[model samples]
Every structure is written in structure tokens, then in C-alpha cells.
Target: MQIINARLRHQAALHSLTMVDGRFTAIQAQSGPLAPQSGQYDAQGLLACAPFIEPHIHLDAALTAGEPNWNQSGTLFEGIERWAERKPLLSEADIRRRVHETLELLIGQGVQHVRTHADISDPSLVGLKTLCALRDELKEKIHLQVVAFPQEGLLSYEGGLALMEEAIEVGADVIGGIPHFEYTRELGVASMQQVIALAVKHDKLVDVHCDETDDGQSRFLEVLAYETLKAGLGPRVTASHTTAMHSYDNAYCSKLFRLLKRADLNFIACPTESIHLQGRFDSYPKRRGVTRVKELDKAGLNVCLGQDSIFDPWYSLGNGKLLRTLDFGLHICQMMGHQDFSRALDFITDHSARTLQIADYGIAVGNPGNLILLDGEDDYSVLRRQGDVRLSVRQGQIIAQRPAAPLLTPPWLSA
Candidate 1:
């Protein structure tokens, strides 16, 4: 398969890429018009880049907004309470349908790599088992990494630790915990310790929901980072939704940044949901419930963006597009400078690939034939217009395509 007249990042000249046996075999500049050949895909000078990665999302809770009752308060706690009401009604078929539909939405948007959290606090472990099964079933089309997430609390909830262990035993690829959501600060600290220990024991990666609150004192991020550093997990550890850092004093954050850098931690900021679910208790001079993304990037720390929720109890909106998240994140993080905009796409692409530890990602020789052609010339154009994905190719095969929306103009206007 050949992709002709595609614009790759950091390359001015149009290039053609070849894929053989599901691996990129060649990439060369298109010198001039050449004889048309069979098995060729004409990109028409569209921006061709690696597929988007969703590093943090809740698959089990996706598309479940207002299942039993609406979260009128619009708070994270309210969403959790509503989810509790809906949990008992879950069935394998119900979860499978919703998750598969969500994945389809993501895939249509050119997202091929996803790291989803499966709520493992259920006594039945239904979410974990279901997601694990889907991970195997969808291996060909998507890379699904399942995190055994204890959504409730690892120590506060009954038999929570046991369920978390069982989830890892039953094919979970990553270990997850909600430290701030624990009953107390001590339990939160313990939860982080337990999650890291479990991950080290099982040789799995750790992604904790750390400090996802607006309280200036939600200090679980420091504890999680300390645990990651102590365990020597380093890059294998991710701290998702460190929104509390938005409220931390400069003095403390200045000190915390050093620890985070030493720990070599990866961070995920879910702009859409965090902005929606956080700062609910604030009145005048309300705060933005997002992490310090621009600062993190400037500090040489890896930070990525995530959609976080799509019609879930926590956030009642989304269409599975990371670009939408990027747009919101860029505005919220004040990352509108020229250099920042040039590298803004990395928040959803390369940075996320690193967080997920996708070894063979991106468009290069010998890498998997996974790339998306966006309907734009550059990242700014694509992002500003929220461009459509012209084609989504996975393993040398086109998996999805969206036709450009036609514009109609009067004859006088056209002339």
C-alpha cells in the first residue's frame, strides 16, 4: 500500500509512504508526477501523522450519563453517587454494547491507541472481565490497554483490595487507584503505596487518579510520585488528573516540581471533564480545575491530554475527538504561543504514546502502518478547524474515512 502526496510533520516537501506486510517499508519525497499505480492511496497533500492516543478514559462508565439519575450538582462526588446507583444494574451485554460503541466513536476519529479504566470495585469484577475480553477481541484494529481501576476506594471500600488484585490476575495490563477519593488522607497514602506495590509485584504499569480535586491541600500526587520513585518505576508510572496542582501555592508547587521531575512521572490532564467536574464549590474568582499543562511541558515533564469522558456521569458531553480536548486544553492552559502551538499536537500524540509506552508507534520505516490523514496542511490548520480525518489506516488497511463537508455558495458569491 502506498500513501502519496502526504505532508509529514517537520517536513516541507510532500512525501509518499509505502507499507508492506503491515509495516512501513519506505518513505521518500514525491519529486514529480509519476505514473498512477494500483494499491495506492492519494492523500492529496493532506497532513498525515500518527493516529491519536487516548491515554485516560473510563470505558465502563462511558455513555452512561444519567443512567439512573442526573448529577444535578455537577460535582465529581455526585457523579460517583449516581454511578453507584447504576452499577448494580450492569450486565455483560450492556457494558459490551456501550464500550464497543464508544471504541467505534474513538476509532472513527482516528484514535487507534486507548488506555481505558475498568472499575474493579464491583464484587463481581464485571467491568474488569468485560474490558479484558474486549482487549483481546479488538487487538487487530486497536491497541486497548486495560487499567484495573478501583473507582471507589482501595482501602475504604469493602473487599476493594481483593478485587483489584483479582482484576490484575484476570488480564489487566495496568494498575490504577483513586487516592484522593479514599476515605482519609492516610488511606489515600496507603492506597497509593498498595497500588505501586501491586504493580511492581506483577510487573504492570501504574496509573493513579491522583489529586483530582480543587482542594489546595489534596497532596496525593506527592505521595504517588514518592512511591513511584521509591519503587524505581519512573516512566512506567502515570499520575492522571492532578487538578489540585491548579490550586497549590507557588512555594509548594515549586518544591513539588522537583520531586515530580526526579520521579520522571507522566501526567494526564483531562481538560473537558476536569474543567466540568472541578471548581464546583468555588464562587467569586473561581478556579480552573485543570492541571498546569503549559508549565509541565516547559519544565521538561511529559504531559498529555485526554477526553476523559463522553456522555458519562462525570461529563455529559463529548464525541470522542482528542482535538476537541486539545482545543479546550490549549485555551485553559494558555498555550497559544507560536512554539507552543507548533508542539501542541504532541499533547495528544507523541506525549501520549510515551505515557502508554507504545514502542512501535509513529510513521517510520519498520513501524506499524498506523497513520491518519487529516484534512489540513498543518497542525494549526487542523486544530483551528477541527479538521476531519480523511482516512484512518491501520496495519496497511483503511479502517475509517470521513468525506469533507461540501460548501454551497450562490453563483454571484462564487464568481
Candidate 2:
């Protein structure tokens, strides 16, 4: 397969790419009219780059909004309660249907890599088993990483610890915990220690829902970072949705930043959900309820964006597009400067690939032929318009493609 007239990222001239046996074979500057043949594609000078990656998402509970009741309170706690009310209704067919639909939405938008959390708080382990099966079943279409996530606290909920262990035994790629959701601070600290120990014992990665609360005293992130440093798991550990850091004082955060940098923690910030689910308890001048993205980026830490939920109880809206999430995150983080816009695609592509540990994930000669062509010429234009994906290719096979929407203007209405 050949892709001609492709405007690769960070390149000035148009280029051509050749793929053979699911691997990129050649990439060079286009010198002549290399017309695409039967098994080739013509990008037509559209911006081409590696496919997008969803670093954090909840596929198990996707497309389950307003099941028994809606979250009228608009708070994170109420969302949890609503999800609990709907947990018993989960079955293999239900989960499979919803997850497939959700993945289809994602695949249409050029997402070829995803990391999803399967709730292990229930005794059935239905969610975990189904996601594990899907991970293997759909390995050819997309790379799926399953996390054994304890939505309810390991120490606070009955048999939660054993259930998590069972999930790992069944086949979970990563170990996950919600430390801040525990009953007490001590329990939260203990949960982090247990999560780290289990991950090390199983030789798996760690992704904790750390400090995802509005309380200023929710200090579980500190314990998580400390444990990550001690275990020497640095980049292998991820801290997702540290919204409580928004409420932390400058003095403590100053000291905490040092520890986070030393630990080399990877962070996932769900901007759309955080802005929606957080600050509901405030009266006036509410907080943003988002992590310190700018500070973290400036500090040279790895931070990426995620679409945490899609029509789930926690967030009631989504279409499985990482660019939408990146747009919202850039706005919320006040990253609208020219330089920021130039580097904006990193949030959804390179940074996320690093978070998921995707090896050889770039537009290079020796890499897999997984790339997408958007309807814009550059990062700034693509993000500014929330551009459409013109073409999507996976392993040298065209998976999805769409023409750019045309605009018509009457002569009388022309400016």
C-alpha cells in the first residue's frame, strides 16, 4: 500500500509512504506524480500523522447513562451512586454491545490504541472478564489494555481486594485503584501500598485514580508518588484525575511537585469530565476542578488528555473523539498561545502513546503503517476547527475514510 501526497507532521514538503507486509517500507519526498494504484491511497496533501490514542476511558460502563436514574445532583458522589444502582444490570451481552458500539465510535475517529478500565468491585467480575475477552478478540483492529480497576475502595468495600486479585488472575494488563474514594486517609494510604505491592508481584503496570476529589486534604497522590518512587516503577505508574490538586495550597504543591518529578509519574487528565463533575459543591467563584496541567508540563512531567466516559453516569456526553477532549483540555488549561497550539497534537498522540507504552508508534520507515489524514494542513488548523479525519489506515489497510464537508455560499450572501 502506498500513500501519496501526504503532509506529514513537522515536514514542509509533501511525501510518499510505502507499506508492505504491515510494515512501513519507504517514506520519501514526492518528486513526481505517483498516482495511487488499486491497493493505494491518495492523501491529497492532507495532514497525516500517527493514529490517536485514548489513554484513559471506561468502556465497561459506556453508553449506560440514565439507566435507573439520572445524576440530578451533578456531583461525582451521586454519579457513583447511580452507577452502583445500575451495576447489577450488567451482563455479558449488555457490556459487549455497549463496548463494541463505543469502540466503533472511537475507531471511526482514528483511535487505534485504547486503555480502558473494567470495574472489579462486583462479585460477578463480569465487566473484567468481558473486557479481557474483547481485548483479545479485537487485537487486530485496535490495541486494548485492560486495567483491573476497583471503582469502590479495596479496603472499604467487601471482598474488593479479593475481587481485584481475581481480575488479575483472569487477565488484566494493569492494576488500578481509587485511593481517594476510600473511607479514610489511612485506608487510602494502605490501599496505595497494597496496589503497588500487587503490581510488582504480578509484574504489571499501575494506574490509580488518585486524589480525584475536591477536598483539599485528599492527599493520596503523595502516598502514591512515594510508593512509585520506592518501587522504582517510575514511568510504569500512572496517576489519573488528580483533581484535588486544584484545591491544594501553593506550599504543599510546591513540595509535592518535587516528589512527582523525582518519581517520574505519568498523569492522565480528563478535562471534559473534571470540569463537569467537579465544583458542583461550591457556591460562588467555583474552582476548575482540573489538575495542574500547565504546571506539570512546565515541570517537564508527562501529562496527557483522556475521554474518561462516554454517556456514562459520570459524564453524560461523548462521541469517542480524542481531539474533542484535547480541545476542551487546551481551553480549560488556558493553553491557547501560538506555541501551545503548535504542540497541541502531542496531548492526544505522542504523549498518550507514551502513557500506553506503545512501541514504535510514529510515522517512520520501520514502524507499523498505522496513520491518519485529517482535513487540515497543520496542527493549529486541525485543532482550531476540530477537523474531520479524512482517512484512517491500520497496518497498511484502509479502515475508515470520509470526504471533507464542503461549504456553499450564495453570491448574494457572500461578504
Candidate 3:
């Protein structure tokens, strides 16, 4: 397969791409032109970018809103209670059905690589098992990475550590923890040690839901950083939803930022979920429930944005669109400034690819033949208009394509 007469964003001239055996074999820009093969796309001067990466998500429990009951309180704790009520009734068949549907939705939105957390706190391990199967079944279409997430606290839940280890044995790609939900400070520290040890034992990546509370004293992020430094897992470790960092004192945060940079830890902020869940206890003059995205980036740490939940217990509204997530992130973080807005685009594409540790994951020659075409002329234009993906191609094959919709005008508006 060859794509000719295409203009990449940074390139000086139009180029041609040849994909063979699912890898880009050649890219010719200013040299000799290559003839098009049976399949060819002119691109029509549209911008080409790397496929979107969904670094953090929960596939096992997605699209299950109001199953047993709705979250009347709209609080994180209430959502947890609702999920607990619904977990007992989850079957392999039910999980596979929803997981497949969710993957299709993501694909249609131009997502080719995804890292989903599966809850292993339940003794059944039904969700983890179901996603493991689905991961293999959908390998050709999408790359699904599973994390053995202890949704319930490790020490608080009965046999939680054993279940987590069992999930790893049954083929989980990453090890996950939620320290803020533990019973006590001692238990939280112990749980971090347990998560790091398990990752070492299994030689897998670490991604923890660390310090998700709004309390200014929530300091689990420091513990996670220390453990990452001790284990020597520099960039392979990820800290998702460190929302408490937003409330921390600036004097403390200034010092903490240096340590995070030293540890080279990756950060993921779910702006939509954080803004909704945090600030629940605040009165007037509320604080934004997101981590210091701009601060972290300024300190040269890898930071990305994640769409944590989609129509799940935690969040009941999501269309599985990464652009929507980016939109919320820019507004909440106050990153709408000129240069900052351009970098905000990286929060979804490049920064996320770094968190996932995807190899050769870009629009380059010799990389995997996976990319997307947007309905805008440039990067900032795409973000400004909240552009939709016009074409989603994987392995040199068009998996999903959308025709442009005609604008609708009313008679009354014609005046």
C-alpha cells in the first residue's frame, strides 16, 4: 500500500508513503516520486497526525450507567458504592459485550492504542479475565493493554493482594494501585511497597491511581515517586489523577516538583472527572480539582491527559472522543494562551504516547502504518475547531472513514 501526494504538517513538501507488511517501508518527500499502488489516497492537503492514544481508561465497567442505581450524590464515594453494588452481577458474557462495543467506539474516534485498567479487587477476577481475552481477540484492530487495578484498597479489601497477584499471573500488562482509598496512612504506604514489589516480581509496568482526593494533605504522590526512583523504573511508571497536588501549598509543591523531575515519573490528569469529583467539600472560592499540568510541563516532566471514565460509575457522560477531553483540559488548566494552547495538543497525542511507551508510534517512516486525518488545515486549527477525525487508518487499511456532513440552515436564520 502506498499513499501519495500527501502533505505532512512539518514537512516542507508533499510526500509518498509505502507500507509493506504492516510497517511503513519508505517515505519520499523531496526525492524521486513513487507510483501509486492499487490503494491510494490524495489527502487533498488535509493534515496528517499520529493516531490518538488513550493512556488511561476503564473498559471493564464502561457504558454501565444506572445499572443498579444512579449516583444521586454525584460524589466519588457514591460512585464507588454504586460500582460495588454492580460488581457482583458482572459476568464474562456481559463484560465482553460492553468491552467490544466500547472498543469500537474508540476506534471510530481514531484511537489505535489504549491502556485500560481492569478491577481485580473482586475475588472473581471476572473483569480482568474478560478483558484479557478481549485484548487478544482485538489485537489486529487495536492494541489493548490491561492493568491489574485494585479498585478497592489493597489492604482494606479481603484478599486484595492475592487477587492482584493472581491477575498478573493471568496475563495483565501492568500493575495498578489506589493508595488514597486505603484504611490508614500505614496501610497506604504498605500498599505502595506491595505494588512496586509486584511489578518487580512480574517485570511489568506500574500505573497507580495515586492521590485522587482533594485533601491538601494527601501525599501519596511523593511515596509513588520515591518508590519509582528506588525501583529504577524511570519512565515506565505512571501516576494517574494526582488531583490533590492542586491543593498542596506552593512552597511544598515547588520542592515536590523537583523530586518528580528526578524520578522522571509520568503524570495523567483526567480533567473532566477531576473537576466533577473534586471541589465537592468546598464552599466559595473553590479550587480546580486538577493537578499542576502547566507546572509539571514547565519542570520537564512527562504529563498527559486521560479520559478516565466513559458512561461508567465515576462519570456518566462521555462520547469516547479525545478531542472533547482535550477541550476540557485546556479550559480547566487555564492553558488557553497562545503557546500553551499549542502544547495542549500534545497532552492528547505525543505526551500520551510517551505514557503508553509505544514503540515507533508516530507519523514516520519504518513506523507502524497507523495514522489519522483530521478535518482541519493545521494542528492549532484542529484543536480550535474541535475537529473530528476524517479518516482512521490502521496497518495501511482504512478501518473507519466519515463523510463530511452538510451544514443545515433554517429559513428564519437566512435573514
Best of the two (1, 3) by lDDT: 1
Cα lDDT tens digits for candidate 2, 181-300: 898888899999999999899999989998898989999899999999999999999999999999999999999999999999899999999998888888899999999999999999
Q: Select the stronger candidate by TM-score from 1 and 3.
A: 1
Cα misplacement distance, residue 325 of candidate 2 (Å)? 0.8
Q: Clash pairs of candidate 3?
A: none
Worst 10 residues of 2 by lDDT: 31-40
Backbone collisions counted per model:
0, 0, 0
TM-scores of the candidates are 0.98, 0.97, 0.96
Winner of 1 and 2 under lDDT: 2
Output candidate 1 Cα RMSD: 1.4
Ranking by lDDT: 2, 1, 3
- Model 1 Cα lDDT, one tens digit per residue, 1-415: 8988899887788899999999999999888634557878778888999999999999899989989898898899999999999999898999999999999999999999999999888999998899999999999999999999888899999999989888888999999999888999999999999989998899999899999999989999999999989999999999999999999999999999999999999999999898878888989788988999988888999999998888988889999989999999999988887777776789999999999999999999999999999878888878888977879999999999988888889899987
| List of clashing residue pairs for candidate 1 | none
